[model samples]
Target: PAAALDTLARSLPVSPAGSAVAIAQDRAREKAHFVQCGVPVAPHAVIETAAQLAAVPADLLPGILKTARMGYDGKGQVRVATPAELAGAWEQLGRVPCVLEKMLPLAHECSVIVARGRDGTVVHLPVQRNLHRDGILAVTEVYEGNLPPAQTSQALAAAKSVADGLNYVGVLCVEFFVLQEGTLVVNEIAPRPHNSGHYSQNACDVSQFELQVRCMTGLPLVQPRLHSPAIMLNLLGDLWFTGDQPVAPTPPAWDAVLALPGCHLHLYGKVEAKRGRKMGHLNITGTTPEAVRTTALQAAALLGIAPF
Candidate 1:
């Protein structure tokens, strides 16, 4: 697809050039790029052959073996606890080129979304605190003080460095892991608007979608300001089922959900509902962080989502 986009960009302008796409598509290249940009990343090895697999360092065990390409939402990944599991994990992945990364102790996960312009100007949304369920994004919280001052500054700087390193020209998301020891390490990158940034739709003056258009059309990119504290809860297809063994899918109590103040729901027009599939998201914004959290919790209770 990058090849096709590269060809198309020859005559028409493209927001994100193919080179950036290529790097984000491969985990090995992504990690290399992060390191080149002076961002810390997890220790890992690329195993494409038996010799390389066998040569993996002992310390890297209890790691995650992930395919270098086409992996998302925890797919194409296997958690290997020891060297003995590496071979089978690789086999399970169909012997594809993979990156084995030492799993680090994490206190929490957060992400930053930056929009870069052709003139090299970069503006970012506030850092987002994220929660993942079953490897899929479950919730995103964005507000002042959601993260510590030092970690916020660090994540913002690293995200900008990555965008500038690629000479990137679009909305890009960089995810990071906050270690228990207060260290920060880059996890991955997404070349377009990300699920974590979805809260910007209602919480910011300029949404990521509009920012993407600006970057593509050579329009001026303005720094987006958060107008209110916000929380976004991902609505998964699992909500469509009620009982433990339901015979048919049932819609949630949207009327009750909408009755809550500051509750905004956006549903994707998917024809079928399957377990683990993303159906929509609920964004709650309010004048105060306390109010937003309370309303969001009530919304979650109504939707059967566990409290944060």
Candidate 2:
């Protein structure tokens, strides 16, 4: 079992020292180290006990409480408006080690997924504006024309620096908080193929998953080329019907969508569903971002994902 864990750890894109440290702690120390190395991060502090929370400075109010480990897709997270809320938050988390991060006012959120090969070559994926419902990512829109070139470059540089620092050799994701000032700050990092990169499957020549496989297998990283502007809509469990004899329903009619040029649909082979769970996604590509957005919304609406 230890060998299995070691093999799995070796497959990750982190240095042996960093990986060992990460395996011992609840959170990845490499993330914090990256933030400290000229990468802007959401202001935060680690807390292991109620006393530490009590002693936190007053300026850090309106903060997000997150478990140091095993948190994802909005789970293991809570918001605290004041010190009075800290005790309850810690209790709710079963007294687990956690981090308190200052609440960031975001203009918009985006992510940059990168692939770095063993030779230290890096490739950046297209930037995607993300939409989340109740902390769960639900949709992503790839801006075709109106993207801020400088911010995209900054995001790419930050991702590369992180990867190079860790000697990362696979697909890694760097999420950003696009502030009103047009600055991109590092939000979090995922050292694997991410859900937000799903749009690449239909939108780009190389999907993030494929890139990861290539990197892990020692293949040279391929630059991702966007063929068309695309929009991705996530399918959630709420769309499925609930009954004693539940039948695996087919996706809503794509006749209208297929009629539109460049429309694509993909369904993951998931057997069951629970409320708010990710099921699959629809990617629609078109000549323009607006057209792609419009067609994607229509297709998602037809699939019973309302208010597109």
Candidate 3:
């Protein structure tokens, strides 16, 4: 059955074998040793029945009810803010088996993306401070450049430990909660070129996607180096044309961005769009974070979104 999924992926127009294997391995571990790895997962109790869900601790209210598999981007999830909300939430989900975890009161979120080769050498993508809207990843900025030296070292070490423990190959990401006291708590891991690392495509010598392909295919990694301070702005579906009729071409403000120097645009070849879907990204590289931020926001505004 697992091989069926692998086969299906390979049948697609572009599927890398090494990446397929890495993703499968990550899914297995997330299901198996999630708690053992010291991740601050919500307090969860697996339940197949409404009665079982009812039996869960009341304190865990305001928790998330989630399906164990195949959930992403705020799908297949419901928030139970109180006892009265439980029955309705369960019914809405069609009584599927689910886990309930305590709601985390997070201050800010960040992720460390790592790339590892078969020989076990690993490289970390710069740490990114992420912003989310309605549980969907919206934008990310390099956070390590702003961190105190000691804190930055701690974050990198924690990420390396996770990569080594998993014997992970290819690009992998570990999301974390950066508390007010400056402590980092593990959140979750994704074993692929993560959304947070998209900025590397233009800012670094080797992009996360290329690193993923290289690591899995046994090619030596082209050591990635950031040439300049960078920022990335996500373009959501709301910016795209709608309806069955062909829409008039309103040329994007690419000219203004291109003229700014060190600005690059990447549009994923997705055929259609809907609210909240990631359509593309604009990256800006400059000497300072302020300059990078300014350029990135300008580019996004041209595409009709709030500042990054």
Candidate 4:
């Protein structure tokens, strides 16, 4: 669909995004593009059918297989801990086109967002430290010096190289896996503003969303400045229910959250509250990172997300 959409965005000459070229260089194709452009990514194999499982190289075992399209939040993925599991995992995914990527030992995960114009100008924001739960974004933290300086610089440089290669226009997010040995491996690519960038809305002078709109309109791209340290806690539908196996959905009390100073709550107005749904997010900002993190823990505890 991304290829189709990219092609569609190409034929329409009237769009304000200056032809909308390279709005998305999707995951499956982006890997090849990255390798060609000298960007480093994890060892992977493209499996289009179940029979291809037998051909998987021995070294790439203990990997994860993912559907090439429409998969998100840990869905459409199966863990292949051993070679024998490959056949069952293939059948589980219904023999769809998938990418078998070897899972790397991680020190932490982070992301860098790039906004590019048709003229090839690029803009980047402060890298964000991301935490995930059940394969969904659980929290985002934006603070100076919290991440390893070497790894941060490496991710930024790699992201810019990829963006330059694609001639990408619009906001593009590159997620990275920092290995235990301190190597940066490109994990995936999101074609637009991503969950990790949402913290910029409260901490930076120019948000990723604003940058996206600017790029699409052919506006001048500016270097984003961070004004405050902040933490963004994702409010998922699980909070609305009592527990994992929730029998009835009940909204949690919002008083503690609303009462906290410097806490900003943004809820998506969705009618249903089914489990795993992203209901909203809470952004907490402060003059310092410690203050921001302390208040965020308090907020999380108040929402019953932590034992405290």
Model 4 lowest lDDT segment of ten: 13-22
Q: Estimate each model's TM-score.
A: 0.98, 0.87, 0.82, 0.91
TM-score of 3: 0.82
**Cα lDDT tens digits for candidate 2, 105-142:** 78888888988887888998888788787887888888
List, residue by residue over 14-100, the lDDT tens digit for candidate 3. Answer: 223343344434433353444555444445677678678779888888888776556677777888898778777877878877667
Superior by TM-score: candidate 1 or candidate 2: 1
Model 2 is weakest, by summed lDDT over 10 consecutive residues, at: 15-24
lDDT tens per residue, model 4, 1-308: 44455466667622223222232333467577778778789999988855677788988889998887767888898999887787788888898778899988988888998888878888899988888888988888888896889888998999998787766777988898878998888887776788888888888899999998888788999999989998889888888877567477777677778788779888889888887899988899999988988888989987877521
Give one digit per residue, the lDDT tens place, for model 1 in 208-248.
98999999888999999999999999999999987679668
TM-score, cand. 4 vs. native: 0.91
On TM-score, the stronger of 1 and 3 is 1
Task: Tell me the spans in candidate 3 whose CA falls farther than 4 Å from its real position.
Answer: 5-32, 148-151, 241-251
Q: Which stretches of candidate 4 lie above 4 Å from their native place? A: 3-26, 244-247
Evaluate candidate 2 by giving its C-alpha RMSD to the native, one decimal. Answer: 3.5
Every candidate's lDDT: 0.94, 0.76, 0.71, 0.81
Worst lDDT 10-window in candidate 1: 242-251
For every candidate, C-alpha RMSD to the true structure in Å: 1.0, 3.5, 4.2, 2.6
Which candidate do you rate higher for TM-score, 3 or 4?
A: 4
Clashing pairs in 1: none
Sort by TM-score, best first: what order? Answer: 1, 4, 2, 3
